[model samples]
Target: MADSTTPLLSRSNSEAEPETPRLAKQVPSLDDTIERCIGSFGWAQLLQAVLVSLAWVFDAQQTFISVFTDAEPTWHCSRPDDPSCNSSANLCLLPKDAWAWDKPSRTSVLSEWNLACAGPVIAGLPASSFFVGCLAGGLVLATLADSSLGRKNMLVLSCLMMSVTSTLTAFSPNIWVYAALRFVSGFGRATIGTCALVLSTEIVGKRWRGEVGVIGFLLFTFGFLSLPIMAYINRESSWRTLYLWTSVPAIFYCIIIHFAVRESPRWLLVKGRKDEAIETLRTITTRNQSSFRLSVSFSGISIVPETFDGNLYSAIKALVEKKWAFRRLMAVMTVGFGIGMVYYGMPLGVGNLAFNLYLSVTFNALSELPSSLLTFFLIGKLNRRSSLLVFTIISGICSIMCVVVGESRQVLQVAVELVSFFSACTAFSVLLIYTLELFPTCVRNSALSMVRQALVFGGVFSPVLVAAGRKDGFLSYGVFGLVIGCCGLFVVCLPETRGGTLCDTMDEQEYKEIIASNGGDDV
Candidate 1:
């Protein structure tokens, strides 16, 4: 055997046995190891990737559920001669008997809790509470995937918590209880999207990263679209039915995750679990190949010899320590904040449109299809910086148009809003995938989580604006436009990582940056 003293990445081993002196046993980094294991994007990898990415479906459902549950049911004059329910009169000013909701009182939170006459702030509380929980959950659970729990375990925990909380939300007796449950539900799902995307991309080969990224967004779109359908089916029933519909499937999905999916091999290797990493890689990549062939493939492969027996927040500390990483994190989070504003705002605020609620939400959800398709097909060709810039700029302009159109031309306003939402959806898709490429594998989950939280932070303001905008358009739609357009400017500061390999360490990343800066030659 070659001397144990020799390093894994040495260029030469001239002092080795003359018989096999040139057969140098160079060690592979985690990226190199994954690339080799996943020689081609076979059905196995796709199945596993899809399984992991499916978490976004539930995440999207939980996110937009309020669109239906908290919706202010349409109302009409109770008596034909009653002028008290005229368009100009405030609903709060009218006698309770002057108007009646078109839908059953059990179909919505506003009617159930007698909150329809509550001011916008109080009416918007449940949605805002959910986002606040997401913020808290993100901060509290940020590093778990990167450290103690690992990606698969974190995903399981998040899905389970989200499902459990949502199931309980169905039984909420009052607005306060509903809002509190929504908060806890938000906390439970805070990491679902991040963990799903991070874990999916990390498990497969780099060649399929963009493809895998699109899968998650597509599934998320599916989830978003499903909400409107569930609401329509239960349109005559209680809103509580919607919660049971989404939560029960998600709880079962947790079981599927437990039995079918494998943890990310890159994550395993990073945590110093060599045998587990190798075994996972084998199971994912090798369907027909024998274990002996897999062993040959792993003959000279080795990890970076790193240990993570440190505290729970080691990855966060590593990110804080690296100046470039910190800068990258900040820039991306800023952009995510902008994207989040429109992404979460538009659907919740769809009620503001004079158009049909179910159709409007369906249109908004349908817009995600083209966005994902565009990103999926052009993922290889699109410039991250340019695409992000263009999408957000277009979204901002269209959002601003919602103000110009006013209520005079309702059709035109909805059209402009759709365009803005479409562009924002496109930006949102690109931003999450782009984030996966920005940081090293060790801190990727944590970094993505922080960025997602920033997006959630932007969402925290959306419900308040959407509620208030019932009177002033600018407070909701106009602000969504400005935040996305302005915050998106931060993308210019980050380097383009399209087509780049994943780095496992800060030093490796610095080396790659230096080589890139030097025109592909080592300095």
Candidate 2:
């Protein structure tokens, strides 16, 4: 018969084991770890991620609506020699079907429509300005996520602010007011994504991080899927109706998140709220019926590192201080730029293609699901650098194929586009995961924001280039693809980070030693 004290002996032995010998206990098999961590909250987390992403999709839809909405009528004065073409009895001196109606009346109607909708057109300026606000928000507010503000608070605040701004945007009295509100909304939007990413990653164990991270992004794609439905419901209603409708759901989501999502234990521990962190862990472990205990004592959360030295100049100075950090930052920024070019550029470019816009957007959105799944699988099995490089190369090859097919062969062009879309989606999904893994917790948000800013910069330029290409042919898209492809070549230089622990503090010595011994790479 086994003694009751044997349980205590086994526990003590496990605790007393040397670090190297403890490897068996320390490192759980990937599948088992995933089964435990992901199994517990995977579906719920996925739902939450999708909800967050849907907000972005609605924002995208709102941004693009201007391109599709009917242009307002414009008024034009009829020449005395030309027959009066207005339909009103007072203005129409000639028959309604006369040639004058075909020319002058049509022109007047277009002119009148333009004049009527000029205010909304002017309002569209805010949509672009919002990106500028996003850049600022990312640089300033995002860093607060892992600090005193905490992830849950910041996320809730962001959601609330965005919802309020979106609702108010529908009620703006003028274009300037609408634009200002959009700027506010953009600021909120920028902070939420990175904050949520940090929060989600923090809640799970290291082994399941990749799956959870990729699923967060899948939620963003779900948002894209939902946008058209929301737009369709509010199609006949004013643009304001769309904003109002989107805002309503967010209010409820805010409540759900407040009640359901706990503060990240990692963040809590870092902030020295050990009790709260432990309780949070207990809640999770109890729900899953897992015998896991957080090794918080050895986890090292004594000091909270500052992300920036207070001002923009200091942040810049800090970012450039180390060679490795700077190179990694540049690499992520380049990848972000390439992803922005393809993600934003492709949807718009596809609209100009012969395919139906709605069908094409759906296809593009659907393509992301598989890419995300592929990323989840590959990220677990392959080195981060290898996965990124392979996907990018495949995307580039497909993009070049798009140019070869041209518009002459519709089926061929579409097939090529489908391939490009698949590869681009894969590259984009990996980029987010790669960016997250590249930095320590202190600078993670700021680093991600910088990369995101590069992406937005690319997005800003793509539209202008696409517009110009209308006269030159699809040369712009081909060139864009080539540029992205060339950028992918840089992937070879980045360190592979697979199976690596996320750096939670700025321990330069530890980082250097790890790099030196482990081939100087990131996973």
Candidate 3:
């Protein structure tokens, strides 16, 4: 019963109304428009996106490999004179009681390397450092993404840097050296994520932005799924081998991008490089075998407007000026922090439970695929706030159920854990999409980075909680779940954004106002 005329059910009135053409000319065909939008890359560009996401997946997997490595049986041992001993000590001098050696008679020997005790702590350093670097980068250079640096250059730089740093991490001789390389690696990693998003938005036609954004994230999840297979194959290999193998794909991707990708036509037009932008558009039309007719005018397209003085004070002022903006920021920050705690904390916490750690992690990872698929299908059909609320409630219920089906019942515990995995995955997938829609393009990167920073902050404290909880009880993880569920309450305050056109600038605030006046219904 949906109207065909209304493409996006969530669009505000002003947004639904087409803007007057700023340019004097217009493009002639859909083929031309598509071609001009993406340039010479064509279908191959999809591979480039996949490769970039794959590099990130590899980075995440390497960071987590230590967890699996640590759980190996080699890391455990039996005490001397214990009835559990399966063999006599090598130093035993008598045969009367070979299995039960006294302290003096027993010679404790390491059956395997105690890598598990150190691996998680050591491997976690790079992921932590990467997020820290992302926080700093978001605060410092996020604005530059749309202005001077341009999305293409920043993306290429990020990719190359990650490749080199990841490769070096494999060769590090000591833990300190590895950690330092990881910090640099993380800087590049953060740049890739931010820049790829910016680049995708700038290159695509305005009408296709939402679709492209969701697709990019879908590819990111694909990367996440692919990484575990790579790890499973190289499980017995040294950690160095894992890093080395992961970095190779990145190197290839960097080369492909260097040769194939083009600058954003919108970025060029905004920078007053009209001729270059036109030439790029022409190239796209030629490739697509269509005519370009759309007007490309700079008069209407504000070039990084000087709304306020460029300073920290000005940025703070901009965020606080509107009541709705402030509310949105606070809600995003709170939900972001909670989701982060659950997203990163749950897997680590589940692994610590008295179960097969690998199987548990695999189940958790597997559950995310369905969530990602569900988001792809439901995003255009459901309200953002409604979707978020539903998933958060489900995930919360599952968390509470985990407490009920504790170690006392292994089968029930496993089933509840599976439920917990899927619910958390659903919450995370929807959150990423919702956060992107909540902000305008002018400050999108900054807003997203801020939310991501909150998530990282949660991740920072999560390991400690997991470690402490294992030693004490499941109280730590339970607290984490309860906190996240409580945070879901904030989503009720957010406006629905499904099927809405992405807001490119704050000048579009009238659209938001219109949507707000409609009793939270889609325009």
Candidate 4:
């Protein structure tokens, strides 16, 4: 029986009975809570994701447009007196051939400017210049997405700038002006994929991130597939018209992106805009057919707490400060450099084959579809390290075989080239997904931009090789095989990221230590 009026055993008895200590409520992290809110996806969320990914479709157009615009048009010598103008003769002589272009002179830069007789260095300048611009643009503009611009703003800005410059590029009266506009367009294009990738992934649930990322690749392939059709339709039209049509539609697309897409909630939280982040999350949950509420905002809810150090040097410094991060960057960039060279070089080399240029480009673009499907499958089921290693190795071996098979067997050469391109596409797709897992949200865009820069850097040298007028496998196939094979070795250094949660800061990304303590290896 309890004593109601006996003072509950008085002060002495109360002191004798120990009180139960209070356990603090564990606050959920921004990522964890956001993931819960997004939950299973609905149609609205999917539509939003797809609309943003349309940027990649336009990106593909800008990226490979040079293949058509800068093609070396077929020509025959008009000078009956020239002895070196035959098919078997060298076409590199500047003064020998008064050329008659098979197509309109304005259809390609080479014929428009009579660069067929020009040295390789002079002839390859515009293509090389475009990649150089891409490299520089990636390096300079990467942090804007991470720092102040945020993902949607940076993406919209890049799309508009790229569209305007590409449109203006069609009006260039001379080679110098043409090359300059390409450089600026490349600069604007540098962040388009980076922004689109980061923003789209951030808005989705963990289970759906890989799926959404693959959609970007698929859309890019669709855009690539469209190029040959457009080229065929305007086969008789000047290359300038191609630029106008592609770039004009892109401008209208950018306006839609600006109005429709929301900023990345992860990035908003990282930048300390709690209210905006909450609003963005609310929008995401609403679209996903869920509801979320936060009566009390967290006092320190940074998505990138480890990256709060304010400075222009923070992104690079973050990578350099950690030994593991630096190692990861080097390994990924090395692989990226190799894959990038082959990826760009393959399409350019397609023109050198015996097939029709339009058919060849279509085949090359089509190769991306199967690779995308394989990538989608592998990304979900396979470990990142092993998948990346296997794909790159296979790509390398197939590439080298193209050289061994020789172009004399045209069917075999083309078959080998397509296989190599297909494998390269798979390697590239996996590499991108793997990279997203390796880096934290704070510097993910910057880190990825560097990786892409390495790829563009590899492309910088491709135009020179392509311009050399050699179909021999050594420069294109052999070199690509060797580089990718060797770079694939770096895969040993990276930890597997399959089924692992993504981190928002550098410390969180290096989970190897925690895994080791738990009696498991990252492999």
For TM-score, the strongest prediction is 1
lDDT of each residue in 1-523, candidate 1, tens digit only: 3343333344464555345212122224555545655664777788988999999999999999888888888887888776656764566788888888888899999998899878777888888888999999999999999888999999999999999999999999898899999999999999999999998888767777888889999999999999999899899999999999999999999999999999987787667776787778778774456656555555555444433445778877878777788989999999999989898889888888877889989999999999999999988788888899999999999999999899999889988999999999999889988989888878899999999998899888787788789889999999999999999898999988787778775666666676677688321
- TM-scores for every candidate against the unseen true structure: 0.92, 0.76, 0.76, 0.89
Instruction: Give the runs in model 4 whose Cα sits over 4 Å from its true position.
Output: 1-28, 77-99, 286-304, 468-471, 510-523
- Could you give candidate 4's per-residue lDDT for residues 1-523 as a string of tens digits? 2332222213344455556212111212555456555554656567778988899988999889988888887767787666656544545653444557778888888878877767677667777777778887887888888877889999999999999999999999988899889888988998888888888888877777787888889998998998988988987789999899789999999999888889987787767787887777677674333223431333434333563476655877888788778888899999888888888888888876768989999999999999988877667887878877887788888888887887778898889889888988888888888888888778888888888888778777666565553756588778888888888888888877777667776655555445555796431
In terms of lDDT, model 2 sits at 0.61
Over the stretch 27-81, how does candidate 3's per-residue lDDT look in tens digits?
A: 1122123344445244444443444344445445544544543333322124445
Instruction: Please give the lDDT score for candidate 3.
Output: 0.58
Give one digit per residue, the lDDT tens place, for model 2 in 1-523.
2242232113453455445323222321222222333343555554554444444444444444433232232233344455454343332344423322212222221231223334433523654656666666666675566555777788888777777777787776655675688778777777776767767776665676778777666766766666556655654455566677667778787877787777766566555676776666656552443323333222322343444454434434566686677888888788778767777677666765667655776777778778878877767776778777777677767776777777788788777777787787788777777887777655666677677777766666666556566655456567667767877777776776776666654443234435566775431
| Structure candidate 1, residue pairs in collision | none
Go through the candidates in order and give each one's C-alpha lDDT.
Answer: 0.84, 0.61, 0.58, 0.78
Error of 4 at 161 (Å): 1.5
Please give the RMSD of candidate 4 to the true structure.
6.8
